[model samples]
Target: MTILFHDTISDSHFPSTSHPEHPSRVQTAWKHLDGLGLTNACKKGIASPASLEQIARVHTDGTIKRAQETCARGGGYLDADTPVEPRSLSAALWGAGTGIAAVDQVLTGNDRNAFCLIRPPGHHATRSQSMGFCLFNNIAVAAQHAIDHHELRRVLIVDWDVHHGNGTQDIFYGDDRVLFFSMHRHPFYPGSGLSSETGTGDGLGYTVNLPIDVQRTGDEILSQFKQRLDRSAQAFEPELVLISAGFDAHHRDPIGGLRIDEEHFRHFLDFVLDVGDEYAGGKVVSMLEGGYNVGVLAECVADHVQGLLQRSLKTGSLKD
Candidate 1:
């Protein structure tokens, strides 16, 4: 369990007034992982600045430059929700860098998998805009990294965030090489993952969005997601898998209505690991995107990592 992150990703870099997407989110996760004795297992990775082309791999150049300049200009808002302070771009870029590091680590077998714990979630950032407290699409960039660098023909992104990963879907909307699946609260922020949006052109039927209704329990969510996961992986046979693991759907989260406990969240991770074992050669990378409640976020992330390691140990690759 090599957790990828850097102090550069701290709130000091991306100063904010009182935003929930602050760096404390990662801090909370670290506290819990440490309490669980998992911190020692983490192999810290440095998050270097990503090149314009690296970002352009998944985002439009105009959007990239604009975000860069917007952060450069000191302060502004991508929307009423996403705010940028002076250090916002560098901090946000660090988020993307965290994902990039995790992707490279997993692909090169530095670890069975890696969890990138960084702030300012990225699932809501689209190809051309940032929204829902997200700037750059961290998971999307990592998925593209797998496709381009690994020459992977098929890649699957499983977003379990309470909100739909609209940006991820939009990035691969019509691409056959990538399959995007999201289980989220419908009619929520950025609201575009209706079941009918299931891909287009060369990617028709490749995108699957399970817009679960509000008030759904984690157990119920996982059951439905399992069907989609089982079917989609068999159909796509992806060479790599990425997760947009957001804890905002947790029962205690102030935002969404999904009521999921730590056990259920761990179950979801186990389900993901099952799929990775079957089709991806145990290649899976996860990047944090959401989770505001410090207590719940910490516990949920710890449980998720514990589950991943448990499965790996069970399979004889990862030592407990």
Candidate 2:
């Protein structure tokens, strides 16, 4: 497995201490990877920013211009939750580009799977607006890149963030080629993921939402994820697997109320890898989303990365 990352991601910051989405989130996870020796254990590469055309696949020209112009003007708030820094536009482009590089690595057989540690975490940014501390939908841009560039027919995106990926769902709502599955806390922020809110038109059954209660445990979440994924894999047979991996659902996270622990995150990765092995030839690319508790975030990220490494080794995908 190869890990895709960018040092510049740490430069994306808002001038507020109260913000839950901090630069320290990615910094801590990187330090944890070094402490665990995972950094030396896998192949690593620096990520480049996505081009305008690449970003335009999932974001409108106005949205892209707005983010850039905001950054150029010394930064401001896009909304009450989303903030911009002079470096934010650059950071967001790299965030989206890192996901694309991960996809290329796996599809080209340079690596079997990859994990992108990026920030100003996406998944909440819609086609026309940035919200919820997100500036661009990184995973969505990568998914579209696979369809347009790689000519992939089926793609599976599984978002395990505590909050539903309203932006991702919105972007692919009418596209049948992508299957988006999200398991999140219902009646939560940006509340939109309802079981009844499946896809429309050609994408009617492609979008699946499993909105869980706030009090649900990792065990329960894993069981539900596995059950649904198993059924969906049989029909969709995804050519590529993507995970909107978020650790904010951890019991200690201040922003979310789920009871997920490090062990459950490992189990979640295991199930995702199993799906990849069975259907997608063990190809998976995951990107960081929301995991705010700085102390526990690193631990959860390590566990998730370790799971990916172990599965890649077992499947003989790890490079020598």
Candidate 3:
């Protein structure tokens, strides 16, 4: 029941007052975790800025340097949606660092599972471009960290955001060691994750994309997710699990059309916990990615983490 947070994420506020991906998103989630008694397990700290080498594991040097330079110029938009202010670079670096720190915590036996609360939601950022409020792909970086730093041969990334994690898929598409799975709304923003776009090269069939219709109920989403994840994990037998945890699929979220409620997240967590227990020894590391509605985001994450922590307690692990 260990959580790592990049406390200064709030500093990466976008320029426009009307941006949906604002700093308040993480603040609300933090407050709700505090109310749910998981915040104390949450270690408040700053992630050392992800070094160029670390970032280069997933991003090209040109893109990484350009992003740094853009943030250095004091403010701009990588796209119409992803805005950068004076504090954006440090915040993006911290977001990446949070993922790295979570991996370290899990690898060092400090925790069996760790949730990182930080964002400029990644998933849309590709190897060369930032999109959908993400500059660096946090989960991608963490997945690489597990492979490099911890020597984990197989890792699985499960993304349940309303939007596709095109960047994550793109980064590890050909690597057999990384299994990328996503369940996202089809025909949405950055719409690239179709069912046909499975893996390629040595990683063919490793990437699983379940592009559900936007009209699904919470139970339906959870059930489909559980089934696919179980089938995939049993087949791949990953040593670790990484989640691109996004709350935007909640019914109250404006961006997503799915009907996932708090109970849905609870069920999702329960299912993931069982899978972790069975395959990964209950090792699941989650990172905050997207969720715009403050109330819904907070409540959903509170429920999700409570499930994770409860499972950790059952497993007798104090760290994660």
Candidate 4:
């Protein structure tokens, strides 16, 4: 259950410190992890910028060119909510590249799993459009890399970002090679996670969504999460597990209304790790997606890393 992260992930930044998706998100977490010595405890890898070919797998050439050209012109908003800067393109590249590296590392047995601590929270970026403060879909890129580069036949993506992982869902909607699951707040930002929105064609039923339309206690949320996750993981029998780990679901978050907290996330991790142990050989790659409260996000990151470490010591891997 060795956890791997790239140090260069901290280089990602936005213009406004007040922005929810600012560099301090990672910087604060890195400092907290460092204070606990988990920064050194976890394996550190270099985060190289992603190649255009890799980006092409999940993004359109137009999308790539748009990001490139916009940043070249001193940066602008890709959408009303998403902003960019001179270095945002570089950040987006490294962020996606970190996901690729994490997939490669975990799949090749170099590490048991990895936590991509990069920013510009990605699950919101569609193939042709970047929105909701997301530049490129990092988790989607990682899952695709696993399917194409690693030759994995079945991959499972679990996104618990409070907001629907609409872009990731769209990219893999018709592909059976990847199974996408999202437990999100319905009628929320970008608003596209409905229980009825299952995958189409070859990917029918592969897209599982739990649209939380009402507020539920953390305990109740965990109960629903456990049942659904257990059944899906058992049936799918995925070769690898990728997580869109967003702490914005925490009750402390200003933008979200969910009552989930740190313990619930740990419980979420425990369940996912159990699924990984049985179906994916403990091969899980997690990427940062969305979390507004930097303090709570940092704490959740620490607990997640500790959970991986402790689980490894207790059960030889990340299982409940």
Candidate 5:
């Protein structure tokens, strides 16, 4: 397993103690994993900040400049929910960079898979706007990297954050090379990802939205994921798999009302790994998105990383 992260994201600030998307979200998990020697056991490195040219793939130059100017002026809010400071811009760039590095690691055969520990959770920022506590769509940039840099025709993205990955779906909505699949809480924040919101143009039928209700059980959701993903993988025949891996659906999450727990997350990983094995030559990369309950989030991350290690061992690709 290869772990990519940035140490400087801690400088981003919301100035409100009530804000949920803080650096502690990943730090807690990193500390726990480190204490258990899990992090030390894996190959770890800091990712270089993505160049402006790389960011331009998913964001307009104006959007990039606006974010920089906002930070240059000592920071302010992009929307009612999202905030930015001097370090926030740097943090955002590194957030996207971690995902890019993860893809390179797996695709270059340096590792079977990789995980990105990032913050200011992305998947909400669009090509021209940054909102929903996200400055840029980290996963979208990484998916485009695989397509543009690696020339992969079919890439699979699985997002299980409690909220729909509206920005990601929007970016690839007209392109056929990428498949954006999301299982999120409907009638919730952002209020998108309806069953009818399929992709358009050359990308029709590539976007899969599973808007689960808060009433559904984790097992039920997991079962739906299995059936739907199996169907999609058969046709897409993805060469690479990317996960917009978010744990905010945990029952204890302040932002989400779902009842998912650690065990359920493990089950989700099982299905994701199976898909990678069957269609993607066992290559997968994951980017962190959302998870607020720090303790529960850390436990799930530990379990998730453990699963990655175990999977690599089983496939005889654990480079460490």
Candidate 6:
């Protein structure tokens, strides 16, 4: 497994103290990855900014222009929660590019699976707008890249963010090529992802939403995730797997109330890797979405990367 990141991800900052999504989050995760020796165990690469043409596959030209223009004009609030700085546009481009790069690395056999430690966390940005501190839909862009560039027919996207990935769901709601699955806290921020909100038209059964309760423990969430993936894998038979890996659901996070911890994240990774092995040639691309508490974010991310490394070694998929 290889880890893709860039210093600009942590260099992009919001001006307010109240914002929980800050650059320190990535810095903390990197610190723990180094402390735990995961960094040394895996390949490391710097991320490059995604081109406008690549981003245009999943986002509207107007939205792309708006984001860049907003940052150019001294930066302002795109929404109540999503603020932009001078460096935000560059950060978002790199963030989205990282996801594309991870996909390229895995599918090209450069790595078995890759984790993108990036920010200006996506999955919340819609085709026409940016919200919830997300500027562009990074996972969506990567999934599209896999299909267009790799000629993949089926892609599976699993979002475990505490909040629903409404933007991702909306982007692929009518496309059967991508199976979008999300498990999130109900009655929470962005207030979407109802179980009944399946896909429309050809994508009817492809969109799966498991709206978990706020008090549910990590075990409960894991069980639900496993069951859903097992059932979906039978029908979808994903050619590739993409994970919107968010650790904000951890018990210690102030923004979310779920009881997941570091150990649970490892277990989750193991399960996902097993699923990938079964259906997707063990190809997985995971992107960092949300994990606010800097204190524990690194631990969770390290556990995830360690799981990827262990799985690669076990399967003899590690690249030289």
TM-score of every candidate relative to the true structure: 0.94, 0.97, 0.95, 0.96, 0.96, 0.96
The lDDT-based order of candidates, best leading, equals: 2, 6, 5, 4, 3, 1
lDDT of 3: 0.81
| Residue 25 displacement (Å), model 3 | 0.9
Question: Which stretches of candidate 2 lie above 4 Å from their native place?
Answer: 318-320
In terms of TM-score, how similar is model 5 to the real structure?
A: 0.96
Q: Residue 272 error for model 6, in Å?
A: 0.8
The residue ranges of model 3 lying beyond 4 angstroms of the native Cα positions read 41-46, 318-320
Q: Write the per-residue lDDT of candidate 6 for residues 46-127, one digit (tens) a residue.
A: 5678899999998899889888888999988888898888888888888898888888888886577888888888999988
Q: What lDDT would each prediction earn against the true structure?
A: 0.80, 0.87, 0.81, 0.84, 0.85, 0.86
Q: Candidate 2 lDDT, tens digit per residue, 1-320? A: 65546565556665466788978888888888998899888778666889989999999998889888988999988878988879888888888999888888889874788888888888998999889998899999999999999999999999999999999999999989999999899999888999998899999999999999876767888899899888887889999999999998888999985988888888888888889989998899999999989989999888888888887877785344
Candidate 6: stretches off by over 4 Å? 318-320
Top of the candidates by TM-score: 2
Model 2 weakest lDDT span, ten residues long: 2-11
Q: Write the per-residue lDDT of candidate 5 for residues 1-320, one digit (tens) a residue.
A: 54545464644644355678877887788898888787877778557778889989998888898888998998888889987777788888888888888888788865787778788778988888898999888999999999999999999999999999999988899888999999999889898999898899999999999999889998898898889888988989999999988999999988885878898899888789899988887898887889988998899888888888778767866344
lDDT by residue (193-267, candidate 3, tens digit) is: 998988899989989998888777777888899899889989998888888989888888987758788887777
Task: For model 6, give the 10-residue run with minimal summed lDDT.
Answer: 1-10
lDDT of model 5 at position 276: 95
Per-residue lDDT of 42 in model 6:
85
Best by lDDT: 2
RMSD of 2: 1.5
Global Cα RMSD, each model: 2.0, 1.5, 1.9, 2.1, 1.6, 1.6
